[model samples]
Target: MSDPSAAGPTIDPMDTSAGNRFAPYSPENHSAPLWIVSILGLIYTIGVLSIRLFIKRRVFGWDDSLIVAGTLTGLVQAIVFFKALKSGLGQVPEHVPNLSTTASLAFTAQILLLIALYLAKCSGILLLRRLFVRDQQNTGRLCDVVLGFTVVCGIATVVMSSAGCPSTGSFTTHCSSTNTRWSVVTALDIATEVILLLLPAYLVWQLQMKTSYKLRVIAAFCFRILVIIFSIFHLIARIKYADTQPSPFNIVTTLVWHQTLLAWGLISATIPNLKAFLQSLSASWGGADWGYTVKAYGNGTFEMKSMGTQSRSHAMASTTGTENATDMDQKYETQIQTRQVGERSSLGSGGSQDMIIRKETVWTVVRS
Candidate 1:
């Protein structure tokens, strides 16, 4: 559907509100940044779907939930962003578009969509926590806290988005600049973004695995942190513009860019997990059973076992023609026992040292 905001009257450039919050009502004000947000949103949506369908396993998992949420919000945001872009970029009409009705409905719809996006983001985080984190703490307790907080934030955002705007279906005024919703939403956003970043670090640290595996887990956490940083910057830009009247540029940056970052982070965070999901499918294709091996010689070797095997016979030189069968058997037994004892002692020492080093590395990374 076309944006309800597009049907408004074209406001001529003149002495007006400093920020011009209602300038978006005119079709002449949308600009490049808004369009860029729309484009990024579209890209994110397409990439998410393509990865989920073709690249990653479509199984029910944290990665799958995240991809779905990202794609859904990304697509919705693209639609709204496009509408915002078109409303601004279109040719100015001889008479102003009657934006009163449009703005009223658009404002209401925007509020609902914003709430939905918030929920989606929270759900994605919860899914990740479930899949990646294995702690001694009760999972249900963590989930309850997250869900309760998310619900509060979602309600707050919805209320604030509509608080200063005209009542539903009324076109008299567009959203107001003094509405506390803008600042409230921004604050909630920053808080949630920080929570998302910090929890993953804790989750990675608590994972029970080898040191190398733990590092991989931490890398995943770092990826999430980077996205949170991007989102924080996005929120900061919006918070700065919250009270300003919406210029074409400011509106695009405030509303559209913020949505894009939220969606983009959701998509980007799932990419690694999606990749892992895809790689797991390779196991079903009869690939070799591959793993690392430590030998008695203090060297680590990577190896794979396939389906074939062979046998070999060893010939021992006879020392005398009078050797009895019992004597020969005793000699073979002694040789086998000696070899086994030497191999076991070396392997035991090496294994113990490796375990110690692994524990030390794990503690260092996790504590940091």
Candidate 2:
């Protein structure tokens, strides 16, 4: 259903006799990776968002809202990808339902994918701002610059891609200038990933946290490196495997790699911010009962010192493996304790009374 004047000549999808021919071997299905990665990533993203909203314990913000939108867009993008696969992607063109249809669907998916990725990155940046750049003026300003730059690059890609190709024409074949545009977009994408990676690594060291604790936090944000890798691979696939015309074999691998990146991108964005909720999962980050000693100390309350006093007194204390909760707060003390989805108590006690101490609290959530 392409505008033949703009897209040029086309053939029926099922008319393999008129379709482009590929390798002689039997075609393999690449949709498995696409399906696995897209579905699972969406499930994880939605599951965490549900906890943030319905459970109502976790603080919600702009980042969470962005993730919700991104997830919806991603779902639509995935469906388009599947439709492309059904049309002819990753198979012998002759065997597919329609090469022209596949091309159109893929173009649509490409647009949606860009939107999904843009939203996810924005969400991550917002979360990063809240975590490290909230109070620091310079760092916060730099974070704003990054966010603005991302917005520009996203718009640039959308404009270039929208003008580059249509449903029926061959892209990356005769469109050398369009390829150059994509090269620019790809470079910006990689730079964005690198910046994201460095943000946490650079800023975590600036915190009053101990070196070891800072490294752990940096490690939690390491998925950005993989995102960079996927970005490069996605560019390569787009530039290398394509034909002068639409072909299923060439597009399938690109789809697979793109899905891989998106899945990991979700992980990269969510894991760092979800640390609080993650620690409570009992399955994440060295689960409970790792031979750590605890005395069960918590007042489970946030209260003020007095009606006339302008100061607040905290009642919860954080303990390491064996550190006592009664001690005053230390500058570099790492909080090592179990956390759960609904704020489950780390220590179970029947006869002992609840002890109250003040512990620093950070309200954070996940996004993808």
Candidate 3:
């Protein structure tokens, strides 16, 4: 039933070995390396999920898109990881079934998934623009342009990848005809990666954060830029060895490095958003319960140090104390009563006052 022409080379015809191939695709030769990488990926994914679930809120905003992107990418890596295990270590019969189709499809999906990861990188930065940019119109227009570019790159990658195959048959021998197109896609991919990495650095440099905060933000973005360097290495490897016989070891090594960077990129991009989400959540619950109070009397107006607004019109008036020593005792008592009442009202009504307020003179921090 077997076609003589369709069978690939024997692993060792003279020895008549049961499972080993004499000459095989590179990845099929070794299982240990792939398994190791797979385990590491699993461990990393677990850590990522934990942080995503349990982390407390911080000062920055979290982008859900980045979260989805990270989750999807981890899943994709896991799929490829299992495939690598099979291809590298699984037994091969004298006439093993050709997996060119399955393998090719898996690799294709991996590439596409990576591109999606990169696009998510770009999208995350665009979201940051919305948060940090004071100019509404500029942010909106920049988002439109960046989004359109992302779409074009994605379409190009999919089309070129599918078209690279010579035929639909999985068993076909020359399925690598589209290598040229892949090269083109890789170049475009690298360009977009560079642009995405640079944009964040530019934005961070221009932000009006404190010197210390600015440095911290810049360092975060810099780590992402280093991920792009890994991509550059991948691109170089791809170009250097694309036409050579499939070296599973070399390819897997390259893929592992690339995936590692991608994992870090997710973490890096999520940091700011994570900070924001926690801060917002903290402010929403029990944060407004805290307050600042100032007790004073006379012609002089009492200012609330904690209140950000220019006037205390929104603040309830405490017992009036003015120009009289005897009134001080009564006035202080009234102040305490009024303060307690306002705090109770605020809690009962569910209002948000800035969680941390700095006072400028006259205003006393009655409660913080």
Q: Which is the leading candidate under lDDT?
A: 2
* 146-223: candidate 1 lDDT, tens digit per residue: 767866887887777666566532233235553355567767766766676666556556645555655554454455
Give per-residue lDDT, candidate 1, residue 319: 35
Judged by TM-score, which candidate is best? Answer: 2
Each prediction's Cα RMSD?
14.0, 14.4, 12.0
Expressed as tens digits, the lDDT of each residue in 8-81 for candidate 2 is: 76765544355454322233444445556667776776676665444323345677678778777888988887
Q: What is the lDDT, from 0 to 100, of the residue 160 in candidate 1? A: 72
Between candidates 1 and 2, the one scoring higher on lDDT is 2
**Clash count, candidate 2:** 9
TM-score of each model, in listed order: 0.57, 0.66, 0.58
Report every candidate's CA lDDT. 0.47, 0.61, 0.48
Candidate 1 vs candidate 2: the TM-score winner is: 2
For model 3, residues 1-368, the per-residue Cα lDDT tens digits are: 98987887655533434555433333234334445655675577556545544442221223444556656766676676566445442223223344554355446545645664665566565555544443347655665676678668867866776665533232233346545765776676666666666665565555444555555545545555666676667666655546544434335555656566556655555554334344445543223211212211121224333443322322323433233443222211112212120111221223322122111123333322
Query: Where does model 2 exceed 4 Å of error?
Result: 1-25, 28-57, 171-174, 243-245, 283-368
